[model samples]
Target: MEKDLAPKYLIHKDEKLYFAFAVIVSIIGYLFLIVSIVGFIVWLGFAILSMFLYGLMMAQIRVNGIRLSDKQFPEVFEKVRELCERMEIRVVPDIYVIESGGALNAFASRFFRKNMVVLYSDVFDLINSADDGELSFIIAHELAHIKRNHISKQLFILPAMWIPFLSEAYSRGCEYTCDRMAAYYTNNAEASMNGLTMLGIGKSLFKKVNRREYLLQSSQEKGFFPWLAEKISTHPPLPKRIDEIQMFVGDSSSSAFRRTSRAMWLVVGIVLVIFTFAGIGFLYSDEIEEAVNSIVLDANSITNDVSSDEDSTIMVQAVAEGDIAKVKEQLESGIDPDIQDADGWTPLMWAAQDNNVDLIQLFIEAGADLELQDYYEETALMKAASQDHVEAIALLIEAGADPNMASESYGWTPLMTAATSGNLEAARMLLEAGANPKSKDGDNFTAFLHAKKEGYKEIADLIKQYEDNVN
Candidate 1:
């Protein structure tokens, strides 16, 4: 009993109106900033610049088709053509991968002969390797976007691009429309569900990650707070989207697909209606409007100020944990292993502590300063020695870290620290590198005495052997 899921609504039927609105909204936004002549000019200048940039991007879509011709997977183009035929679409957009996209994403651009589809590498890798059913269904969904002219409809709502509040609504509507088109072409309700799930929920290594559980989790996310957040997003919540397809295709009979009762929608509608009027009233209220403006300004300022520290921290921790893949991500993002954290600890320091000799060698080759020290005046070698990481000690010594250089805080050479900790292997390596065995610390304790106190018999024996050789 699957019903027609095709988007019956022609999103772009009124392109002229949409174009008019884009222009009108741009002008209105500019005018709104006209409290001062300087503000008006600034606003107008920015609007013009944005329009020009977007125009340039649109112009590039023509060449995008040529660029798509060089794709690593030629089969994608064939799939696009087949889907376009099935959907009775007059044009199939040239598809290309934006290798720069580090996340999963796909977007369609308007063009003269054909629109353009820019698939991120992440998404292409997923779809290209999927089973035939999953892969074909996904292609159909993208085609449905073109067939229903969803991209044009979104362009028609261009005013929302200027109006932040309405812009969010416009974006979400586009997603809903595309989902309907996807379900229409896939025909199987489950296939459309699978496509949406893939987009929202990335593939997991654990095969037991249940789709039913995922749909349930998505459903629970539609409470008041979550729905409010969705209002500001360009896409519907995954559960709501899944429900939309299931409802359209008469698949709601599944317990997992059944939505909250009609009464719930009624209550939500009343609440929304009330809030709409309330919002209109508040916009006209000087005090409320001022408060809203202040909040917006503060939020924007905060967002702009939060630096990208997570990239470095994650890289550092991954290096410590000996994770090659995570290290690669940071490197790909142009992270510097030599870059010191707040405590002046670099990836080399973490590698030393973890006794990761290979990673130590890697960081050294990547231009890590072998002499860099932490707040504790511990060089990577010192850290390796204190933890008795013999292999790491060997790598650092080979990397030419100065064995004679004493820590500024502890005033102990690498040899003194290694001897005191009873790391005989580290002590032997440092001594061979011409370390001054007699180097003393703040406590005036020599490497020999420290080794005795730390109960390092083997290190003590090595130190005595060095002493005898000196005599």
Candidate 2:
């Protein structure tokens, strides 16, 4: 019954604001493009390159991925057809399954005139194990994107992407609309919320995840930074999204809900004004700086006696400055190799960050704890991999650092760090030294998935090859 309602009815107020702002930005961008030949050429070149790249990627997926039809996954294919009818989509979009190495994600993308939905293999497996309504909800969510022409709208609004909060606001609104449509298609609010839960925690643990307790945490996400993060993000936080769905399903609203909503919009309005002024200031910065400099020319200046104190420990300074001789001298003088600084950074950790192989070796020989973690629970190995310090990573690993050791915060391994940074040599070193390529972080993302997400194609392929060989 909800599907019968006009699609425009689902569009949020923020979505309308985003579109109006985006239209203004696009007009200005077009005017600039017409006036500046170089800008037009540059934009055209980038647009062509992007289209080509996207087309190639889509072609690869179509060629290599599993296509679902009536013959294969008949029930799922039938459900897709049914949802397409309900959503009033004339063309049934093609569906493909690609290997994600355990990442839980599905996306609907457009290439030229063709619209396609990609379901990560692991997520597909999750859907297969769940009730038909779960699969229906997922498929309908993606189909809703197509039905609403979101992808094409995004293309039209491409120039507005340079505008900070406006573009992301539009994207988040689109997500909310799609979620509503998905619930409408399924007519099962519980299944709809559970689908989002599976995305957050994955299939195995989703059932055990208390929905009320999870949604309750949204009340705690307040203040400027949290509001700014959501404003700049393409998707709303999962808890907020789930709550929005609950509200849509005629759930009774609370006073806390009203307060949070008002606070979020207030932040958005304030940030919008601030960024608009900031953009204006950037355009006239030279004139503004000259005027301010002239006005402050006669301002009183205060002077203070400053002292240059060489106060840090000899060993810490040596490691920080990459002084091999000082490090050797301090080691000979019985300086503790693992002495931490103000932020809990050990000498070896500093050396690792600096990619100082000599200092790393010196600390290792002087009995530095290879497994010593910093304040963030990041080991020297993680630091080396983060900076793509191949030789330093090798030295740390050879000195008995665990390649599979995960950071306490996000369970990010040294391999995950290397893969994310596209450090091929460091990834290879970690993989050869017994780093588990399939090892997942707190979000269940493997090193391969990280590489893929970052568009590090070579590193992703290397991880895939290593994983295949291991299995």
Query: What TM-scores do the predictions have?
Result: 0.45, 0.55
Best model per TM-score: 2
lDDT of 1 at 303: 42
Off by over 4 Å in 2: 1-4, 255-471
Top lDDT hit = 2
* TM-score of candidate 1 against the unseen true structure: 0.45
For residues 1-471, what per-residue lDDT tens digits would candidate 1 score against the true structure?
Answer: 255333444232122222233334544554566667887787668868966887687676445523444254667676677677767874456676666455656677654324667666666666545444555566666666666455554443343475543455445555666666666665556766766676665644313456667777766654677756865676767767777677666766665544343223223332354334434443344343244345543643344232223444677778867997778677666776676655767789888989987788878877888887777777888888878887888888888888888888778788778876767778888888877777778899878888888898888888878877774
Q: Which lDDT value does model 1 have at 315?
A: 72
Error of 2 at 3 (Å): 9.3
Residue-wise C-alpha lDDT for candidate 2, range 231-343, written one tens digit per residue: 78999888877888887776636422433442244344434543464445445544543443443322211110010111125567777778898888766765567766656
Deviation of model 1 at 197, angstroms: 1.6
Q: What's the CA error at residue 177 for candidate 2, in Å? A: 0.5
